[model samples]
Target: MLQNLSSPSLQPSSASPSPFTHHSSQNYSHAKPWPLQKRPLTRLSCASSGPKRKMVPQSEKLEAEQLVRSIMWNMNGKEPVLKTLNKYVRVVRTEHCFLLFEELGKNDKWLQCLEVFRWMQKQRWYVADNGVYSKLISVMGKKGQIRMAMWLFSEMRNSGCRPDTSVYNALITAHLHSQDKAKALGKALGYFEKMKGIEWCKPNTVTYNILLRAFAQARNVEQVDALFKDLHESIVSPDIYTYNGLMDAYGKNGMIREMESVLSRMKSNQCKPDIITFNLLIDSYGKKQEFDKMEQVFKSLLRSKEKPTLATFNSMIINYGKARLREKAENIFQKMKNMGYTPSFITCESLIMMYGLCDCVSRARDIFDGMVQSGKEMKVSTLNAMLDVYCMNGLPMEADMLFKSAKGLGIVPNSSTYKLLYKAYTKANMKELLQNLLEHMDRDGIVPNKRFFLEALGAFQSLPAGMETATATTVVGSPLGRSKT
Candidate 1:
């Protein structure tokens, strides 16, 4: 028989005695022969009561998240993550184990999730249930581990757990994560067709939502239309997520007219648009460079009860920057700050690039410097932005200086860094600097491919005839000649 690891017998006993326990032998007959004075009973009055402490209950999800974080941080012993997990598993409730598996799955620790699931199966409390298999399949599907998800389905059936609608839904989602998009869609359709014949496994709203969203993402208009037709024929009512998912997918693919049609359908169904719906519309319009439509959506969002998120401002700032509307981008950045949204790394990177593209190099430098002083971990993108700006503005000398300081600042130069510097040096016709860069590239193991040679030749061809031949031969030969046999 499987052991009950989390049983009360396995847990540690409490050290302290209960306060409610009575000492029966103690006498209290003459302890309080009180005075009969008529005093106002202040303690009994409602006004005299102290403020009640607000007890915010900890949810299972929060507890699971915390447990996963704790395990990840403290698993220092010479054992696998699963083994370390076993020690703690013996003390927590079964529900907590399920939650931990979910947390691990979300963090892409699929192997560890499998270990926990297997451990649960060995416990006496575990029974063959469709929910466990359904959830596990969903997790595996999310990580694109379709083979493992299929194996789980086979194992679930062997354990006498019959497949339900939720389980079928999980299987369809797993197929959607497959690398072959056409094959995945075909399998999903096959499952949908199979589900129709099984009375107990009739497709639910969730099933329809999944297939619709998948088809919309693939931009399979024909399949999306057919699915909608099937959905209308069914008794299941489509929820807000169903519409929202379709709209978001369509908007991402730049199908604005189709997205608007979905919005109209939503309104007709009496389903109110949520914050996500507005964010999607705003982002789509902005990406299409339709500023007027974007602004109209922004105004409508402001008027509606749904508050704007940081994503709302981020999308607007990035798109305006792309459109070269410097003033508008800056205005949106300022609006985000006024609304108490702290600038994230993405926010800083976007602003820096925007300012650089607009020839406002000084403003970009100020933002970079501010970020440095604030002690936030600088990302490579930030450094690359500054370097690109210097090169773009005919300040390669300044860019070289920045490159030298990068190592001291703990910022590592990537391939993009080398590419930018090489182009800059080649343009300036700094032969000695170009040679040094080649040596550095060789040391860093970044091999000069055909594309690199083509760019180098193009840059050299721009020079006078005599200089061009000599410089091109010298530059191309240096890296190849210096390479270790």
Candidate 2:
């Protein structure tokens, strides 16, 4: 059993909050937070005991990524990543361990993260550093392991690591990921208030960014306004990320007025709009189907000094495709190419989706075939996009035909492909097609779970009752099907 290493509940008063001392050594600025853009893999200058926190060379950084990738590639699905970490205990330093946190966090291997932390504690170089705890808290938080995150916070204080802005920020983020979001926000504000008092734990720009985005995501307009006001009054000046985060949250939530208001605030502050700023406006307007505004933003982006990124083009293409503006979507694609932008796999997929939405099946397939013939590595999503187009156009047999040849094309179908096909086949009332898909799923060792059935049955719900009953019986009796409990 993996040991339970969580100490007592966090008593912030018990630990003497140490003033952060910057490392004078040219190689390190260990006392500071790991830059958010870098995460665990970015660099190796975390504050820790002993002499290990130093500026690691690029080779060392690559070594960490390579080591994690190798472990992931070699795992037997059940062996603990900690088991692999054990073999590399000597080679794995603080930087390598940090990268491990990120990679494992991606896979939601939060327990393994704890196990790795426990292992790190036994090592001679181990120190109760805020960066390590902040990262652990972040990983657990992302995994929705709120209790675990809380434990790590307590453990950090117990280990004599003083809580800093980064650690508190991570904790606040972890709470926000919890199901009781209202409670989480309250706790986050509580912490934000607390941070103001503690000189060493004072809220920084990151702290404000986290809260601002959180409130915006919750559509708590009043709170967002208050936070923004508080931010402006504070010593910390908002950066591009500040406006971008606010705009993105509001844009995604369809709070157009709030989004535009934030953009205006960004302008009033004289923070020049970057590519991200333009892209967010385009996406927001496109989502609301306000094509005129989207195009206006696009035109402005063209006039700006900043170059449009792949996201800018991809958003335009997909949104145009969604609106069945095939010519416009095509024009955007042409413009991308004319401007020397090579189409990404996602770009190709967007074109496929666009063509399908516009009833241009032949055109979509033409692009797919061209991509395949060019020896571009076929991704499951790309294939799924093509299959989805066929299904959307009432071409079940065609989708099955392409799906059957997927392995031959060096593209393997995952559960998503199976789910897509099953839903489509069931809705079409094609028994043979559904059975064949089930067979393929079995061969791929994918057992259809309740969620899969629920989604497939959701498609069945709109059909005549007799047809729904008939298809459900077929599903339950199939070799690979398990009835929902």
Candidate 3:
């Protein structure tokens, strides 16, 4: 059992609140009170210390096992929960260990599940049964452990367990996800052919869905067409998952025409689009900067009775704000409020950027300042955004001051910050200051790129009379470079 490490008490360094110190007051102009704290989640059992026990009662073990099962179920079948359960299983010694392993594998905890499987093999009660090996192989394949999964599938047959279509589909999915996808797909096709030859185990719609989704995600549009043709020839009908996977793949890959074609195909097949279908289309449209199309999809989502999740609003806010359509962005921000959706850090960041880009520097600063006051932790990205706003509004002095305060608070400036400083220094035409910053950038691993050096050279060329004459570095040979002509 891992002991919980207590958080150390660290004090803030200065008497005066650093300008970089977080302000927690949220912008109530458009957004409602977005609660920052969520209900405390049940800590992973492995991360928490267990009670000391000596020969625990069967009833006690049963109660603890039930609690573990509850945790596993509530986590929506995640791998972290399985890892925690496996650790707890060792401590409690439960008979339902295999069930835990199965659930673990379903959650993609293949390595931890394998640990339990190997442990089972060492036990006297271990039986090389078909169901056991099939489950193990299916789990391994789902996790992309194709070689191990295939070996287990063969071993199952050797141990007298019959091969099934379900087992074959799992292996196919695993093979498709493998790094050597072409090789895996070839092997899958061979297995499919062998299944047909045997006549005992036949490929089903599920197997075809797996193959379709694999081709879709791989962006092998040619292979997708071929697979569809083969499926039609075999009379294996495609399902909603098949279409949804293809839509998502096309949307993600920025193939708008391909995505629309798939949607048209789905409609022709009499398949009604779902919320996921609408969401993916909207997301893809937004990514393409096709705001008009994105809005159309969003409206369709509402008409379909699918209550927009936080994700839906977040996408709109960011996309609109990025396009500098502040009015539309603010309207969505207000709508999110009316819907009882509180603005997150991401929302605030979008607001800051939107305001900044629109030349509303003071408003952007107010949002940033209020965010800090509201106890929301300012991420480095947010800080950079504020810093950019300062520099852009001809306030490099203020930007430099903020940088100093940020550094004191241990917020290391990144390359973006250096770039901003280079721009600021050149605009100010402070040769000594620029040289000092160049040294600082080098120290911070922000090596000046060609563009940065060109900007610096341009600033030097544009320097005022006395500024250039007194500050210019001398070249050994040239008249002005050597001594004043």
Candidate 4:
């Protein structure tokens, strides 16, 4: 069990159960928090209008970044961050602290982010502001720490800081991150309604963006429609993120017509399609195996001002691979290379899976070999991609051989790797091989937990075996395996 992973990315309603979601990819970058947009959908910040922030010079920004990274390396036996902060107290500024939150938040160190916040408060220059509380709430929310976020909201008020639109937005988004979908949805709506009566905390586009995504993912079509109607009647206008999040939610739920309806509404509102919009369209069509429409969208993307990204290519390759459109997938890869797009480990994994589906196991092996010999550190998933090909293609022996040699390649196998192998070995009815794998699992200190035992009763739903694929915090361009926009 990957307990309480703070991915914070939205997904289709588990209730909808789309076949497309069984694709089984991991570590995608598109899982950033809601309103996953590069541009500010609107000036929706709850930060009271203040003097313009002077841009930190590039040199100062780089210096601050280096300082944050150094503190993070924990190079000493003791707490380097607190010690360094005391020694270099002069450098302790709002921007630097924000950078600290970012680095710490990535590693699930929300408590440390709070420590830094406390340290800031102790400074003579520190001032309590809605922005600080909002940032902290957002960080806690992303970590699935809803109670902490609520406490922070209360603490902000106790500190004489008024809750603002931005603060409410963070609180609502945090609620959505909670495990109980029904409770989370109800609580988010409660906050949404509460924000309405507060004069200064009135809802903004960002607020709507967050709520719309929540309801959309909950499959509450009526509520989604009601929200949009309210948006039209209000002074706040919908933006790219608003439409993008809704469409993405619908698309993931296999509500293609609703997704398209969003596109039409978007055009009617004069909100232009950006890269996310195009990628979402491509992914939706690809999953439905509507090749002509997918290709048309790709062509349109090429004609647009926004260029294609690695995600764009990765999604197409995996989708084509799933359909066994081997040549088209290869052509896309070639085009990606010709466009000077460098394939990442993700792209390589997609390629491996693609080739496997095309019955070109040897070709898949060549790619995996290049990845191994590239001398770059490899991911377990990349190796699993090759292993998946072998296991899936009825070559458990070859997969076993690769698994044994994984340590030599500096790749450490995790539970997923074991799960994949376990499924394959049992499927092949190789008793001796299963015993060998058990030895490896025991040696590695991995327990074959109860659920894993349950899994033994069914064939491992290897990724796609069948079908198919974003990076970037804002998820600008590529759309294969992203969080619902």
User: Which candidate wins on lDDT?
Assistant: 2
Model 1, stretches more than 4 Å misplaced?
1-65, 75-78, 379-485
TM-score of each: 0.71, 0.85, 0.56, 0.80
Candidate 2 lDDT by residue in tens digits, 90-165: 7767666777777777787788788888988887766556778878888888899999989988988887667877
Worst-scoring 10-residue span by lDDT in model 4: 467-476
Q: What number of clashing residue pairs does each candidate have, in the order they appear?
A: 0, 0, 10, 2
lDDT of 4 by residue, 1-485 (tens): 01111112211111211222221111111112211112233433333322235454678768878877776776243675567678768766666676777678778989888888888778765656566677788789989998898999898888777787777877887888899999999998898889899898788877888888778888898999999999999999997678778888887887888888887787666566666777777888787888887888787767665666677888899999999999999999999999998999989999999999988999999999999889999999898899999987999999999999999999999998988987887677665777677667767877655667466546533323321010111112212112231
* Of 2 and 4, the candidate ranking higher by TM-score: 2
Q: Ten-residue segment with the worst summed lDDT in candidate 2? A: 1-10
* Cα lDDT computed for each candidate against the true fold: 0.71, 0.77, 0.62, 0.73
lDDT of 3 by residue, 6-55 (tens): 10211111121211111111100111111111113342111101122246
For candidate 1, write residues 307-417 as lDDT tens digits: 667778878887887788999998988988997888887778778878777788898889888888888777778899888888877778888888878877778888788
TM-score of 1: 0.71
| Model 3 superposed RMSD (Cα) | 16.7
Q: Of the pair 1 and 2, which is ahead by lDDT?
A: 2
- 475 in model 4: Cα distance from truth in Å? 41
